[model samples]
Target: MDAATAWLVAAVSLLAAVVGPFAAGHALLTKREPQVATAWIAVCLIFPAGGALLYYLFGINRVYTRARKLVAEERLPPSLAPHPTSSSHGIGPEYAEQIRISDAVTGRPLEPGNRIQVLSNGEEAYPVMLEAIEGARETVMLSTYIFETNTSGRQFIDALSAAHRRGVDVRVLIDGVGEYYTWPRPSTLLRRAGVPVARFLPPRLIPPQLSINLRNHRKILVVDGQRAFTGGMNLGDSHLLQSQRSHRVADVHFLFDGPLAQQMEAVFAEDWAFTTGDERTPPKRATPHDSGALCRTITDGPNEDLDRLVMTLIGALSAAREEIWLVTPYFLPMRPLITSLEAAALRGVEVKILLPERNNLPFVHWATRHILGELLHWGVHLYYQPPPFAHTKLFVVDRRYAQVGSANMDPRSLRLNFELNAEIYNRPIAEQLALDCELIRARSRQLSSAELGERHPAERLRDALCWLASPYL
Candidate 1:
């Protein structure tokens, strides 16, 4: 070999030797999942120069780092409001530990006197939400993952614009990534309509902000600091199954009237402040009476608030005595969660999980199939609700404790996305949610070990591959 070519080869080998191990070591030290770490480590070692660049660009936990910076600068507001009137009465001693778990994780008090109404779909949720916007006397703070520019989304845009024109304190926050679901994005339409709107962490070229993993997946609509709406539903026509012929989704949303609404307002305020750098002054809310239910909101994301909802879920699952009913669109449970489910079922608790028979994301559903045998072996019953794909996310324990909101059972919702969930300590509400699940369960088909085992080898291989990539999904 010539002298110049030999020098080039030596330089390349030296660069690989230095960069590859560094990236692999970083993944080993920082990644939470062993499989994820191993995958990155293998990539770094196998491809050396290119793999290290990939790890530097995509493998690092830049989301958490950026979030930590926001917190350090006091840009991200605290999850809970101040001077909360926590209700300790009427709740049984059985839920004391559960209460403690949430309290410790969120530091948010249980807001009493919350009157929650279940809205079946956009048909029910949208009208009430629009009515609340129309009737807003003070403020209308709305945030959603997707704000499509379809027929249903336009109604919301018009309502928010009308509310703004009427001198109401109106603010709309749409997820940066989800805004691209349609052309003539809602932000643009809202801007043209004289409504104040902001996109959460939108992709930008000037500032070079392009990361899309840590998205704002929260769905919140707080009106007048007295009424709020939140759930798995988004502001889009797909949720209007009554009118749509295909790609329709079935979901549930809840309207909160009482102190819980104020708490939700606080959550929106924090998210808005973080997104737009505008500190919103929350309106003084009247002291609400102890209505029918007690609830607390749990806000989680890829920041310091990470793992809070998952911890709350594990705590609730561990505390389940009689029954546990969980429903979600996605079904990729982490190892600890799967272990908790197994333990719950072994303790004589009836553990039932409901998932969609058809999924909007087929890869997620395929990945979910890979873990069915493990859960089934532990006496956990799993069911698939028939299509029009179910988009509801719910968790109920013993018909006394329940949770509902935008966070799904997958890693994207629990670990990466900014999700909002509420823990309800009302027997009636829990029973109602459980009953809803029961009705769906009746129409659903339960999965058996034999069914999973009978899958073709190639199909199982595909599912296994998808499962291995669940962290990214």
Candidate 2:
């Protein structure tokens, strides 16, 4: 071979050798499922450098998104929201209310008459949560994916420790995957302090056998078996909001004091059961009374079709009569939901999606942009909230139905991971969620097709790549 050709060949060969395995390693680190890892293997073996770049920019990122199998026993029907067989999409108040009660004692609803309060962020959520812990009259249950051992996490631990000290039943559950890194793990700290702490699905070390994507993404806290709190918020030190995230985050949490709160209490019980092999403290049997809210507790795990959360949201979108407003930090909905949002706008449902201008996951940013123009064209209003990456997952429909939880709009939150969301049929909760969404919209910049089209070449290329990774983002 000529000298120049030989050098070129050698350099490219060297590049492929180094890049290919590195890409595979990156995928392994991100918890890419075995199938995706295998796909990466094919891509790397075939295209070499290009495959490695594609996988790095996308594929092997966040293994938690892989199609991890949920313990089959946990998955409920996709229609947990109630059968929409009737021409009317709205669930009957009686039916929805019954779902809340039955979720705990039985898989049915009870009359709800509890108060619901929206807590803005950790600054607001933590204190109230601690107070609840302090005042725990009976059992105290807490579950979360990320439980930091930082300033805020310590306070909750102390409160729970105190509750434990007070001889109240206190059970704390933390995702084994999310809190895997600690001196002995934060749960250990709680356990040593005489509080019972359980880890959910601790990672088992298996080399080259990738795929443990089924993660518990729900963040739920219940005290006294009567009051509960849930939302996208995790117990971490990233207290308030910041416009620019130099590694920052923001979230929303809600407190409930009705029969609806009992549902969250039950979700915690189920997880505590799944992990610790123990059941929740039996409820103080009282004649179930109404707390005055129409609600349902719907959960989705593996062993069922993927994207149950998004599918549930699609149900709302399909039934949307007036306006559909959604906010999620990472917005990679599966095809059906993507189509549903577009169709909703096309069919005259006023649809709006609020996302972060720059989320922690930029590849997700690209994925969301790919269809932004399509949505905008279909009369869907796309708005980008200025940063700190508000991690609130909320949906509002016609001032009637609302959903809030830790699940993002992406497939990972829907299909691959365990997610908890409360479906509220009351007008007040719906109105409140809608108003908050509007407040967030005020801080956001609306995007149009013209601006997206005007983006620089490099920026556009990145977005296209992001869209390609949308399925797993």
Candidate 3:
């Protein structure tokens, strides 16, 4: 062989040796999970060049770094800072422990005097929300994951445009990836209508920040800083069950008025600032109501706030004495959550989880089946609500405490995507949500160990494979 060809081969070998160990060392020092680190290390060493490329493309988490930097540099507007401690007036002695746990999990105080109304679907929620937007005299802020430019989406665009024309301070934030659901994107229409709109983490070639994960899955709408609407419902016609017909998605949204609205607005302000780097002064705080419930906002994401929601959930579960009711579309919970569920059931706390019979994502549904037998073995009750695919997410404990928001039980919602939830202390609202869970349960079929075992061998294998990939799903 020529000396030139021999030199090229030696240079390539030296480069691979350097790259493989460098990538493997980064993974070993940074990865939180031992299994994940070992797998990446093995891959990097086994294939050398190809493994290094793959690790560069997918193994490193840029989302966490960017998010942490942004959070560290920018702080929430001063007007929205939490009080010294949670309010103890309306809270009872029984819930003192839960309050303390939440206080530590999230450094926010329990805002009292919040009036909450559970709206069943978009059909019930949209009209009132639009009415509030129409009457807005000061500011209007909205952030949603999906903003389809369909019939329902057009109405919102029109309303927001009109509000902007009236000299109201209006801002709209739509998820970067979720804006592509339809042609002539909602961002395009909003901008054309002279509304100030921004997309959160849009991927492009110029600057090149491309990630399919790390989505902003939060849904929030605050009108005039006096009332807000939030929950699992997205802004699209699909949520309007009666009108959507074949493509209907059943979900629940909450209409809230009082100090909680300001807390919701605070969260919006934080996101808006993060997206645009413009932290305007927040609007005036709403007058505290005479009588209402205590509420606190819990924000979770892949950065500084990682694992907060799950920790808060575990805290609530540990504090439960009587019953726990949970409903969500996805069910790929992390190991810690699984252990918590088992412990809750073993403690004789009536633990019930409601999930959709047919999920929009079939892989998640199949993966969920693989863990059913374990939960059933531990006395946890599971139910599958009949179709149209319920998109509601809620957690009610002891008929006196509840958590409502856009976060689901899956890894995507818990650890990757940005999420928002509210811890509520009110018997009436919690009892109402528990009643709704009961209604869904009545119409649903109980999932038993026998049913899970009846699956064919091939089906079981498919589910096992899916379960193995649950962390990514």
Candidate that would win on TM-score: 3
Which pairs of residues collide in candidate 1? Answer: 113-291
Q: Which stretches of candidate 3 lie over 4 Å from their true place?
A: 1-19, 47-50, 72-84
Cα lDDT tens digits, model 1, 45-116, are 999899998787567777657674444234223333222344346567877778877777777777888888
TM-score of each: 0.92, 0.78, 0.93
Segments of candidate 1 deviating more than 4 angstroms: 1-22, 69-87
TM-score, predicted candidate 1 vs. hidden true structure: 0.92
Worst 10 residues of 1 by lDDT: 75-84
Model 3 RMSD, rounded to 1 decimal: 3.0
lDDT of each: 0.87, 0.72, 0.87
lDDT tens string, model 2, 1-473? Answer: 99999999999999999998777677565543566667677787788799987765445444334233223134333343433322143446533433332333223343345577899877788889999989987788888888888777888888999999989988888887889644447987897899998877776655332234667888888777778788888886765553233666778898877666666776677777767778655455322344455555667665333444555566667777679999888877766787998888888888989998987776788777877877788788989888676777888887777888777887777766778887776787888889989899888899989998998899888888877766666
In terms of lDDT, model 2 sits at 0.72
lDDT of 3 by residue, 1-473 (tens): 89999999999999999999998998898788898899889999998888987777667666557765456244432222324556447467878777777776676677778888889888899998899999999999999999978888889999999999999999999999998877789999999989999999887767776665778998999988889888998898999988846878999999889888887888887788878998867667787788998888888887654487998899889988889999999998888888888899999999999999999999999999999899999999999999898999999999999999999999889877889998899999999999999999999999999999999999999999999878778
Better model by lDDT: candidate 1 vs candidate 2: 1
After superposing all C-alphas onto the true structure, candidate 2 shows an RMSD in angstroms of 7.4
Clashes of each: 1, 17, 0
In model 2, the Cα lDDT at residue 296 comes to: 56
